[model samples]
Target: MTATAAPPTSAPVGALSSRRLLSAIFALLGVVMAVWGSRMPAVQAAAHLGPGQLAVVLLAAAAGMVAGLQMGGRLAHRYGPARLLAGPTIIFGLSLALLGMCRTLTSLCLVAVVFGIGHGLLDVGANSAAVNLERACRRRIMSSLHCAYSLGALAGAGLAALTAWAPYHVLFATVGILTAMAAAAGLPLIQSAAHLDTPAQPDPTQHDDTPQLQPRTVWLLGFLAAACLLGEGAAADWSAVHLHTLHASEATAALAYAAYSAAMVAGRLFGDRLNARFGPTAVARAGAALAATGLGAGLLIGSATAALFGWMALGLGLSTAVPSLISAAGRGGPRAVNAVAATGYLGLLLGPAAIGALASLTTLPAALALPVLLAAVVALSAHRALDSK
Candidate 1:
């Protein structure tokens, strides 16, 4: 049932095959969802909803994501990564199309929940597959796999900006098309529906025992993951809004997120090299510092252009932390994947929801400062928390 029990086979050494293909496909799906979600402001405006109503709709998506992530790892463990990968992708594509059709607030909330489930499952399954493929390839391929996700996000943001003047339904339709293409692209990589069992490795200490993650380590990794996800979530949900507050046009405000996405993509592409040279602790520490500084500058300067640049710096700074943390969590063995994913997702789930709640209570500007301060705390603890291999 566990990954370590699988028999070793010579598939190909670091070759581009099923896993890489699937990662790319899911990465594109991730991009589409991110773009569609990022354009929520437009969606809300079109529906004539106030901030409170919009927050409710957003919470539905967040709740679904948390639920799906918690369950996805177990599903992957039971059925294998390929089935887990394909099923959710189809659902994601369908939900995206459905998202375009919803008219009422209730319909929108319903579709958002479905979309969140699909997105969450796809996230956990694809990343699980990527880790497996990397193990088979015997190389550091996780960062590159995540880089694909970042690229997809960048493309989605660009597509959204380009078609902002068009009907929102058209944008959703385009995203659905992209999602379908990604799903189709992944079909060749999936092996079968039946679970394949392999023998567990011999252990002198405990021949009959199964591997499991220590509870304490799982909690620690979860906390670290939450910090990283919260930082990224803050940027994703708020950077453009911050730019708009500084008097940027709608198109230009979107560009603030585009800048962040671009920098993030760039960072992920080179992340492995940096990780090799500096280690996860150093990278995380530096990233935290940069994210905090960028956020601070964005808030203090009060210029649209400067705020955009600051967001870009924040993106570049925060890029490697999540992927690195995921990799570290897996170090304890395959059993750690779910706990790690679930815990990390808890942060992802909370980050935006908390921010929205704060924005409701106080000003959006003041609420934005929360993640900046959190990032600073992460930076200060990076040396101790993230350094564990």
Candidate 2:
């Protein structure tokens, strides 16, 4: 029998450059999120608003994100990922800087809406480009790219603490300028490094879902992504509240989210190796189960330490789920990836609000059960939902 020839080795330049660009984009996005998130207390004080009013303003931003996601997808489909990437990067930085400059509640709300629009567009563009890059590389690198996001988030959050004494607008504007510069520099490197071919010379891996592009498959992927992100949104919004409700000190309660963010970073850093070995289906199923179990335990124990541990577990459990789902969605092209990303963003937009609504009817701890249930649903369906066969 003739010996099987080895598959030709892929070039490293485009793949390497794409990975760098994706990492920078993810990190910058994380920085923008942390810069704004870390200043929420300051914003509330500046605007002189209560929790309910703040929620309303935040909802405006979420709505903008949803609209942006829809439009960004269509735009990416029509214009290509490169333009979407370059344009949105600058807009995202500018909008984020504008957030700190808002003096009135109305101004804050409107700026938030615009920021959300930029954020949503940037997210879709980056993830869509990532999918294309992964196809070019023929490897599992999404987890590592997400790890960059986690690292940037951690840095931003930490920096917020150091700059807590600085003027809010000044702090935000400084970060925004840095982000804009990075975007200008990093995006061109990505273009130079990318191995894009014309439609006539499409990569085989890139064409896997082109023929099918089934609406049902896309919807199922979106549902799975939403389930994962809902848990993430809840953890981000309510972990501290849950700790405070359980009677932890103010300082201790604040550490709850830090634990989650840290665990997510660690999980993602190692997730690429895991995904490569076990495949996305296994990684997702196991992760969802862990998230459900961890969050449930935290709620059940009702202790500060347990809460921290739970958040950590929850972060680890959810970290790989999104990357796996997005990678799968990417095969279907930009529109498909955007649809999945949009659905996931909807979960982020609505999950916290749903928890708050339920908190009014029941209790905060009880409301958290919603995410746990969603995670369990993901665990049960992940294999089928992510199946490429």
Candidate 3:
């Protein structure tokens, strides 16, 4: 029942397969996001949601996400993290399909909550599993697994674009059914790996003297997660619009996010190796500093090209930040990770409104400085947060 109990020759292979399975789960979640996001307009129209009503539906989902995170954490303690992954993920996929079927605001909102819950639970489950497996393997893999998410998002977006003319219901159904079916294969492997990789007995000589993270340090970790993730949300929501204001062509404006996404994926692909070499605190600190500096120069320069490069820099700089925090918090267990993830998600929810509010009061470029400032705070605080682990 433990990896060490297996033939010595098979341990590495088992670890590799487990990591890949977990990575697939991450990618599938990304696909769910891209499909749901890209099809939102259709959902709004299909459900006949009025102006600002869509926000209500989204808010419902957000609430469910927070709830799911809490539930996932508690369940992980009872059922084990690997066993906890598939149920929520399958539910998430199914709810997504159901989302396209609802024709009224009331019905859509209900399904949205379910969709969000599934999203949140699967996120925690997979991540907690990653935390456990990472320890057993004695390596840093959260970055590579997170990159799988980015790649899946890009692929999902591309497919959504190509299938733009299809009925949203058909699209959702296909994706949902496919995901539910695939889980039969991929998720079981992840659970089995967890079972195999976990040791039945501890080495008597090794004593884990590291204390559970202090509550204050937990809040600091949450703050860092929020600050950096807010920047990511800002880029997703505002990058194209920012480019448009600078007189970039529509096509060019679209490429602004493309550049950012590409850079983020690239950075994550290399992030684990970098972390192994430089340490999380150092790599994350340097990355946050780079984001702040890059965005500041971009806005100050006031050109389309400058803005695109700036966004790219910001994306790369913040790529490893949240993953590092999650891995750190996981040291305290799933509850700690739940708090960090839930708070970080709140930042994503608040980011657009916060940016828009600031933009209304000041110039967009000036408002954008908020993330720059927060990024700087992350750079300043990375050591404090990571030191807890």
Pairs that collide, model 1: none
lDDT (Cα) of model 2: 0.81
RMSD of each: 4.0, 3.7, 3.2
- Pairs that collide in candidate 2 are 14-193
Span of ten consecutive residues with least summed lDDT in model 1? 192-201
Computed on alpha carbons, the lDDT of every model, listed in order, comes to 0.72, 0.81, 0.84
Question: Model 3: residues >4 Å from true position, as ranges?
Answer: 1-13, 195-211
TM-score of each model, in listed order: 0.83, 0.92, 0.93
- Residue-pair clashes, model 2: 1
Runs of candidate 2 exceeding 4 Å displacement: 1-8, 50-52, 196-211
Error of 1 at 146 (Å): 1.6
What overall lDDT, based on C-alpha atoms, would model 3 receive against the true structure?
Answer: 0.84
Question: Candidate 3: worst 10 consecutive residues by lDDT?
Answer: 1-10
Clashes of each: 0, 1, 1
